[model samples]
Target: MIHQGRLKEDSLMVMKIVGDAICANENQLRRYLSKRQSASKTSSTLKSLRKYGFVERHKSHLAFEEDDEISYKPPAPFTLGIGGYKLMNHLYPEHSFTQPEQWSKNSLAIQRYVAMNEMRCLSVEAGVLRGWSWNPYIGGSAKYRSPLAVAKLESPQGEIQLLMERPQMAQNFIGYYRTKLEVYRYLYERDKYFKIDGFSKANLQIVCLYVSSSSMAKFIQEEIRLHTFPFDIWLLSNEWISEEKGMSEAFCTVNQDGLKRIRIPFLAPKQM
Candidate 1:
């Protein structure tokens, strides 16, 4: 019971920050970071990353001893805290953060607000979004997941870094989630629109949808339940894909224009 929750950018950074400190845990991580989120939110933020088993929680206390037995380093040249700083300084002489002599009162003269904004763009929050994009990412000739429409960039700095990507798709499923009624309304409306497009045989269309739709995920989950109907439906959105699992067996789709754009958010909901 590490009390894991969805890992947001800042939360992930908090984990990295506190995790790298002399001795820190979720409790200590909170005490050191100031944010506008709630108490429970702060607690649950650690849950999702447990998927990767990145952090471990103890029943009584959190212990951090650099275990020689463990091989838990992030991908190449990536380190979290002071190690990150030192690594970046050595790797990037021109932009090395360690040398203040290289910095000037007027060097990169940017307003505090502007500088902060730039920092935010390169922060853990932004990086998580980039990593979690619902965007189509197909890698390797045979891989179906297309590359992200807008990719994330990681810039190493002294104990800091950035993740580049779009924001909406990775939104927290809190107040951001639509009400059940609202979701249904949106579903009906979008379904109507798609029906029209299907009947119209439109060459292309732009459909605005989000990837957090449970109905969509449900459809994918029930891919086994997909039954062939006389009619066929295809999703065609570049950025959004509704991955329904059972649908693969029930129906067939055509990859059009180097895009198998699926309206990934429009699957039928579970039967309650």
Candidate 2:
């Protein structure tokens, strides 16, 4: 347990990771922490941190309880506590830290946050995650839409600037996606006009869509077939990503030439 009004090295690292992601669950935090540490040890650390007001744990309702495939529920997610926010502010004065309000009240938004944290963990394990940000703005002017998350991945070929979106299943999601596609296309055409740190039109290689089921994946894929996008649009299912294999599993995309299957480049996980 933390004492002496001070945090240990591991505790500080945990707070930083949670602060960076805005919100992450216990399992996700364990995956990102040192592999040498046992699960029990990680849990102990979190308990201590919470006790000392370094982190806050938020319980999540079973938003996907209607889905028959899910046999178990996930754990509550964590956010920076008052102490953690102060530490982060001291560590990186330029970076702003805002506590997410009503994070658990909106089911869809919470699900998306959890999914993004999962992806972030995968990237960290693969050792290719150069940088990551949540809800990043993606256009030239102030009137720009933010993707769910943005990540910069390093590979043998080059750096890949990726924009990720996970739209909840809805009646008019197809139209929403088409409009999003058009905005991305517009940014791609006028790449020179806009510039954001670690993101650019030339380097934006993949726009990944994380859906909930195979049917939704197929529905989105069919809609994607109607348009020609400058960047690759990959469709992934939540079930597949939650499996033991994780991102190692292959995902499919639809282009002018029809459907094509592909894996993330340099996706080998670090040996434990």
Candidate 3:
């Protein structure tokens, strides 16, 4: 996601200096910053550093010591650049949150966003998650339908979901979501591949994987319960899901592999 903020070279340079305090000089750093980004704002980068407690002004005739230089660290929810990792290892060698620990869901920024940021951008294809990791059940299924499929070009202020039948190879799901429903498009397609029967078609997105593990499905339900943007979360499955880690009963029975699907309706909670 593009942050609605700037990454000024000066600020980025300060980040570099903090990473390697011993070798960097301000003039060279300034040159580097000038080369990387076109100037957009003033010193908000410095202001941000000060706000995050990562910078300190030096006195004339600066005392020489490793700790005398800026000892700033990025905030817990902040994004990291290329140099931040080594600096993190140097400054916070023992901090638990710096690592990826499943049980400690909030440690890493990616983990926190994946697990706790219930604000999902899309849904998952059937039988993908809860399996041995890296299974491409995603692209396997034929073109499914959407639980919250977009129809009339909804508001531009909301997020964008790449409506797909399944996952694609080498795609960046870190910024996406997926979803699907069995029997959704198949029967719906008999007369309405384009929705003449007024039934919803099966669909998928890639962003749903970001939800915390135990509550992934529940997060989908709650989004429906509270009327989260896009559409209510739903899944499509057949015999493939008889033992699925989180599925109960889905739209149809898994049979011979074919380019087919069914329809399923997904709506927000009534009170919402």
Candidate 4:
């Protein structure tokens, strides 16, 4: 049985943040708490939340790098626990909740989500509130299929929608890569009438931001160019994401005509 004592203000804040982001690891969650907050303190807060059945910690190994016959490396990531979902559902009735079935998907899925969220965060820093966040299960049906998300932006003359796609490991599986491209090809052809998010189809644009290392980014870029599919392509690196540069500088857009750069709409005033 749980007492349901008064929830601490910070705990509620953390729960909402995790809910908004879908999931966050310990360090990521702590960054929202305070830069000066120690790991032990954050752990304690998580412990309390877990004990109260408000959040659960998921153990994840995001990678397995083999440096030698005896040495291996792995990443530790977290997802919401059962209690966390309960709390999240209570707070955000507009959203549905589900725990990640396995970490294998996180290698690309979670990182993609994190990068998208980071971009949104930067937009928030610029004071823009109009956008959408999506889950892996985005879109209404299999035929329509979903990209990472659809961000609605207001340009100087009109509104535009930006579709986001982050390829997890495009080089290893040619079929998977082609399949995604084919889907995009389909969307590109019919975007003018594809009604998503209550807005007209003519305003939507797709941007596939590469989050992997430079080598992978290059490989993915070449793969897309080989197909010559029409859409905005960009390479989002850790260095660029860390700075306050507008989307134009942060993302190097690629096209057949050559690379083009454009400022991302809805950036904070300061960023503008």
User: Which prediction has the highest lDDT against the true structure?
Assistant: 2
TM-score of predicted model 4? 0.69
Cα deviation of 85 in candidate 2 (Å)? Answer: 2.5
Q: Could you say which candidate leads in TM-score?
A: 2
Name the runs in model 3 displaced over 4 angstroms: 1-14, 21-26, 38-42, 62-87, 90-272
Ranking by lDDT: 2, 4, 3, 1
What clash pairs does model 2 have? none
Q: What is the TM-score of each candidate against the true structure?
A: 0.20, 0.82, 0.19, 0.69
Q: Judged by lDDT against the true structure, how good is candidate 2?
A: 0.70
Cα RMSD, each candidate: 20.7, 3.3, 20.7, 5.2
Which digits, one per residue and each the tens of the lDDT, describe model 1 over residues 92-175?
Answer: 455423222221332221121121222222223323212212223222222332211222322232111111121222233232
Pick out the ten consecutive residues of candidate 3 with the lowest summed lDDT.
127-136
For all candidates, the clash counts are 26, 0, 31, 8
Ranking by TM-score: 2, 4, 1, 3
Which of the two, 3 or 4, has more lDDT?
A: 4
Q: Candidate 2 lDDT, tens digit per residue, 153-215? A: 888888876677776522256776777777877886787433444465444467777666656
